[model samples]
Target: MLVIELRLMQIIGLGTALMMPIIGNLSDQYGRKALLTLPMTLSIIPLAILACNRTTNYFYAYFAFKTLTDMVCQGSINCLALAYLADNISYRQRASAFGILAGVTSAAYVCGTLAARFLSTGLAFQVATFVSLFAVVYMRIFLEESIPADQGEGITQPILKEGEEDNIIQNDDNAPTKVPPFKKIPSLGYYLKARFHFNKNQFADLMLIGGIVATISQLFIMPLLVSPIGDGRLLSIGLFASCVYAILYSIAWSAWVPYAAAAVSTVMVFAPPSLRSIASRQAGPREQGKAQGCISGILSLANVMAPLIFSPLTSLFLSEGAPFHFPGFSIICIAITLMIAFIQSLMIGRAPSTSNAENSTEV
Candidate 1:
């Protein structure tokens, strides 16, 4: 059962890794509003299908549709939204903005998880279908495009800046050819094929290492002392907390140890968004979308590796005839990975700080 679920997760990750860059890049080329709305609209189909049927065939179909929609929706929305935020806000406010965004998402996740625990599966899916439809409708009717257009373009029209502000405009006859989307797929296919294999220990490593990427989208802590603390130091503190979390989970002797670890892990939420806020300052105005897309791509790659790594490890350790008496061996492996992340955070602290003038210009 664990293997089956892991296989499903593997497929979802593959889809995400393959499709995230395309959707994110397209959001940069086209507009955020459109790219964000389209995939969400598509998600309704799978939800509706799941709500209506519970047969084995329908279950498989739901998985297929869910994977496809997740590919389109997963990292794309967050990437584009960050790009949009970067475009509109000043550098000084970016950390707070990102923190608020992460906070809201974390709150929503908590609420949704609690709701899921109580709701029946079929009824939950039915409610989700309506919720998705509502999201699509709300986005279409209420969400406004933030991209700015030049003089002579309509106020509501999205700006399409090819290069930097005044590089060169080309005629149709002389313009450079665009690469077809198909050209990109072979590389993604190769990545998936090459990375599909993993051992139990490797799976455990992936799952532990993946916390970095997963936390980026929803990690948050209070921003009261951020200015005084600096992003680098704050990130290092969070990473240390995460290391503690990994250690606690690894040595957990009882079920309540997991819950206690969860309580402590809340401190780890500060790391990713601080990293993002710092990185956002490093990128130029025109390249925010591309940069965020690359980050999302890395996150997708992490997602791809996680299921392949963790599932087998989990199954092995939980089985009756395990190598040693340690039931939490997989988690100890994850702790080692977390220590690596903690070291990376310390390195981030060693890097030189950017000047205020440079930061002001970048925004």
Candidate 2:
């Protein structure tokens, strides 16, 4: 049973990793609002289907649709939102903006989990779906585009080129010819080349490495969802934990979950902003998108792999009848590693006027 579950998770992970980048790329071409709305709206269909599902085949179908929609919504819409925030905010204020976003998301997660526990799963899902749909509608109707239509076309050449007049705008005839649509949207070979040829700056490199390490660490911890004990043993542990959580949640006298969620959210909000701001200050505005994209991509990959990698580890630990020490320890190690990387990045900041020099270069 464990093996089969692990394999299923692996399949899900690979599918997500494969699909997320495509979604992100598509969002880059299309507007973010439409991409975001489609997924949120379509997500209801899968959840609604799952609510009525009674058979294993229906379960599989539900999982497939749900996972695919989540990959599209989360990968593309979420990534674009972050990039949009970065685009709009100055470097100095970005951390605060991210912090607020993180806090809201974290609070929502905690509240959502608690609500799911209290309400019927179907009802809870429906409410959540409606909320998301409403949010999509609100954003579509009211939210302004941060990136101008013209600005989002692609990277513009920096104003100040060496030995060239700063204000000069070359005629269309003098500009390089645009590639044909076929060449622009190349086959697999071209896609691979484009992906691989991304030029990363120091901060981008740090983000990519940090993202990979953070993801692998998180993945190592997630499989413990089944616990270190066998399914029979883990079931009791999960039930107990859920019961305790439910009781605490029901009391409603204190905001324990919300507070914890706020802390976690705050961390997430600040971490990226700090990383981006420091890196952008070092690397410049132009390369910020690539750094953000690469980081987002790495995190998405990690999200995909977490279940696959952790499920087996959890099974192995459970088979051995040992307490699940690895998950906590792995998370600690990852935190330390990220902290060190962040510190190292700060240390590297003392170098000569490197900020604006590389900002305008295309990644």
Candidate 3:
């Protein structure tokens, strides 16, 4: 299951890396709302399939369509949504708004998970499909387009004018997806169950607690830190905090220690929004979608490399015939990745930023 999951992650990563930049640039040229509608609509078909029936034939059908839709929808909507916000909000207020957006996302995740626990799997999919449909309708009716589809500068701008598209596509073209691993690898839960004796109920409890922390930090504390500290520095801080969180969990001698690491997430959770905010500051209002898409593309490509490198390492280290007895070895390796990211983030502070969005101290 774990190997299969990792392979799936690699595939999704590769597909998204190729697709995200195109989607992003198209959103810039067309409109965020219209582009967003595609993935949101594609996502519904698979869910609606599952909701209707779960027989073997239907399950296979669901699996095929789910794979197809997930590749398109993963990370794509969020990129467009952030770009849409960047278009409307003042750069000064953008970080705080991004934090709010992330908070709401975490909140939804928490709420949905909790809700699903009480409902049957069939009901959960039905509800999810319904909510997705409602969200699409709500977005179309209520949300104003920042850059109208018809009024975009032109499709040629990002290609012919900047010449940055090659760099965007060529470099960072292999990072991969983070979200699908759980669904793909049920063994992850089984592994935790073996190591920590983590039962379903206990896992749910941890999620509830972690969700509360994530929601509060993203909504309140993160917004506070961004305006005063700047996203660059905040990103560094968050990355460093994330290292501690990962290290703490990797070497956790007791079950409680993992929960303690979740507490550190109060600060660690700030990294992603901070990174996105910094990226947002770098580009002009007109180029928001392109910039965001490039970043997302890079991240998706990174996902591809992640599984290829880590899956075997994890499988070997976790197996009984391992060279070393450290169950936490793979996790420590992940911490090293965070540390590398941390080092890169520090350079952001050293470099001079031209945008007041990154340098401004006013709250």
> TM-scores of all models?
0.74, 0.55, 0.84
Arranged by TM-score with the best first, the candidates are: 3, 1, 2
Sequence-dependent TM-score of model 2: 0.55
Report the C-alpha lDDT of model 3 over 1-363, residue by residue, as the tens digit: 656766776777788888888898888888888899999889899989989999999998987887777788888988998898777766666778877887877788788878778999999999989999999899889987767333322221111113343442333111101211111122334445657889988878767777777788888887766645666667778789878866886687888886676787688777777777777766655678888888888988876886666656666777899899987777778789889989987765344324333333321
Indicate the TM-score of model 3: 0.84
Each model's lDDT: 0.57, 0.41, 0.71
Candidate 1, residues 1-363: lDDT per residue as tens digits?
Answer: 645655665676677777766776676667778778877788788889989998899988988888778767775766777777767776556666766566555544444544455789888888888888998889889988755322211111011222322221121110000011000111221222223434544433332323322333333344564555555555667677776766665565654454355554456666666666666656556556666777777766776575467546655665678787665566567667767877886664334434432223221
Deviation from native of the Cα of residue 329 in model 1, angstroms: 2.5
Highest lDDT model number: 3
lDDT of 2 by residue, 1-363 (tens): 645654554555565565555554554456455555666676676766756653789778887887667554544554556556655654434434543443344445445545665788678767776777677788889977543233321222322244333222221111000111000111211111222332324223322333333233223322232122212222223223323322322232332332232222211222333333333333233334444555555665664465444434333432446475332232233334444544544333233432344343332
Clashing pairs in 2: 223-310, 223-311, 228-318
- Candidate with the larger TM-score of 1 and 3: 3
Residue 359 lDDT (model 2): 45
User: Considering only N, C-alpha and C atoms within 3 Å, which residue pairs clash in candidate 1?
Assistant: 203-309, 203-310
Model 2 regions more than 4 Å off: 1-5, 18-22, 51-58, 149-269, 276-291, 304-363
Report the Cα lDDT for candidate 1: 0.57
